[model samples]
Target: MGHDQVVTSKGNDHPGNGPAVSREEFDALFEALRTWGRWTPADRGACNRVSPEHVRRAADLVRSGTVVPLARPWDTEPGPDNARPALHYMSELGDAEAPEPSVHKDFLGADYHGKAVSHLDALSHIAYRGRLYDGRTAREAVGSRGARFGAVSALGPLVTRGVLLDLPAVSGEKWLEPGRAVHAPDLVAAEEALGVTFGEGDAVLLRTGRLRRRRERGAWDLDAASAGLHVHAMPLLAERGICVLGGDGDSDVRPSPVDGVRSPVHTLALAAMGVPLLDNLALEALSAACAEAGRYAFLLVVAPLNVPGGTGSPVTPVAVL
Candidate 1:
């Protein structure tokens, strides 16, 4: 919890991870969390749990009406993390115009599935084995054209109550260093310490102080090491019935604990439980705002771009207090 205290584990090359888990163990966890043939409109998946009453209750939580945007800036500059930088160029300058009114137009484009941009991962974005969510075949459902089963367009605007798991603040640290693995016990401890409970149709955002750490200590490759949830933590979230999962990272502790599983959290949440994810969110401002508001629960809204047959979309979610 101190500046000198860092979470380190003993593995071959994983500096900040837990003990290595076998593929068999990970598959077992996946089966336990799998909720196939459970909901109507399988594309909506766990989002169906959110009823009108849930939205009304979430709206009532907006007392201060302070809104906090939970997205990083459009990353145009290349960095260690941003391998493919987002494109932004002026299309038409304000020069030669027919009339007195001149215009300036700019274009924005990105491959938003990576770690640099804030994005929402739909169910079709991840496929474990050869299947998408709800037993949809990956090859047949997602082709060169785009996804047909669980596209981002299927998930309309998401409005729900959000719970922020401020790990660094609870640990008395500025930020949790990369490779720190947060397990099921860590979630329980945070729930008690933060005085917030994880409920059905609620969006849980894990704040490991990723942006703060990246700003203080430069950018590093997240594929090698990152602060995120271990596979063992998925069961607790499944039991709590969370509708959405999000964090500063992509929700997988890197150099992975599970052998052969590059992203076990993505496998469990997306492929197994049909829970969408918000990745690469900027949660530092939200953390501070929640701390000042004396409560970690707030109204959270995520509106992804409606691109038919698209896997996901670049998003800028907001949390209102």
Candidate 2:
């Protein structure tokens, strides 16, 4: 169905099956993964892990020259999760009385910091305990003008090896049900099953088959419940030295396993590890492409808009196999 045509119902909360994490436990994990002051003063955050050598190596993975675009369509209708659907309307239409030449124009806008749009979250996007990555106070770094420290402009263009951890494919399931928590063990199992391993400078994308589930079962409140990584999985990702983390959902399993926190993974990845996140990606086509090619790793490139002082940018990342 067209994006605007999908009807949605109140989303059920997916209180994942993982053990509850106390505020203290969550704080400990945050401290353990924190990369504050690790790199030079910069807005790229963990993206600095990707170097020229990494990009060269990633380019070597493109053997079949297959390209997959990992962006959901610009949703123009609101749903339980998409409170602000993208706007698409004609701005100008050709008028016979105007002149001999005719042209058509349209406009587009979105409050993309939601579940419907595919977007990248800059380090400035998340703040924990009143501070951002690199120990910048949120109030001091971000203001009405935008972010001064972690703007998307500092993260120029991202080029690295992309790893697709297809959980459903590994488990012989079509999709992991909402409220399902993917822990460290799941990552290890998926790596073994897919014959792929995580490494530094890699963009790890976890596909829980969210879109497929919605297509088959109809729309529900995604904010209330979604299949994603638990806070327990952050250590593995940090150990692997990933620069980018993305998924069909926002990368956090909900209702958050961490007590008193809404998006623990977001906090861990962005505020603690300084890793940027690609949220709300449409990874179904990438999964099919990987399966057809018999490989899960690819050369991934993402170029966010150079919006100075902006928190993040809407992006259409591309993966080549």
Candidate 3:
């Protein structure tokens, strides 16, 4: 769809102090953003936007050659948001019988579909109204064997230009308060303030200083309330043709502004637009790097494990300036 065709959330206010998104409104938005049958019947989804030309343009962003890792540490402790903790232990610590080579082996595991782990969510990770992306029934597409469509294996290494919209930097706030909603106007103002613009085939990362808040005040119930994009902001991103969207949070503001939908942004981006998401990222270092360089755009590289039929995979994305 063209930018001119982008939908706006203007008159639909909810009963509470949230965006006025009724079930009907959300359904309309979903239909407007749906990309069913737009590409070949495949699981890669919106990632097809990143052509070879896009990769070459992204490579041009690497000037200073400084690398920044964007994955939060594998958290093994449970918290309010992290219902399941990651696992880490040594399998062998140089205690084996006499051998030519000595090795210290470790095991790591996680139920990564939670708040603690940094992971990529494939297009099949979410389903709306008992249907997966491209109108595949959830029952038929996802079973005990795993998703038949939109598996992480179909989404290989992602190399593209990443645009960081550091909201805290623009607003001069230590962090946006929890339950704050980042709307479309905020995104426009942030781009103007940072002198950065997003375009087609870009990976947009939103930073609300989540880590800084956690450091200063300690962890809270993130699922209860966290700063992130409101569903009203989806059209702006859709207009820009962004393939990947991510944030320090799971990219959805909590206590969902959308009526009846828990994760409206997730539903719109993945189930509707066929866009993938990078969840639970650590963007503190990226924020500092951008401040130092006076630039917010860089070459981003994310390689998820090639787990066939898996809903998602833990990942450590890197940004090169």
How do the predictions measure up, each by TM-score? 0.96, 0.95, 0.94
Best by lDDT: 1
Instruction: Put down candidate 1 lDDT per residue, 52-94, tens digits, no spaces.
Output: 9999999999999999999999999887789999999999898
* lDDT (C-alpha) at residue 133 in model 1: 93
Instruction: List runs of model 1 lying over 4 Å from the truth.
Output: 1-16
For model 2, the stretches where C-alpha displacement exceeds 4 angstroms are 1-16
* Model 1 TM-score (2 dp): 0.96
User: Candidate 3 has which clashing residue pairs, if any?
Assistant: 13-20, 14-20
Candidates arranged by lDDT, highest first: 1, 2, 3
In order, candidate lDDTs are 0.90, 0.89, 0.87
Query: Candidate 3: worst 10 consecutive residues by lDDT?
Result: 1-10
Q: Judging by TM-score, tell me the better candidate of 1 and 2.
A: 1
lDDT of 1: 0.90
Give each model's clash number. Answer: 1, 1, 2
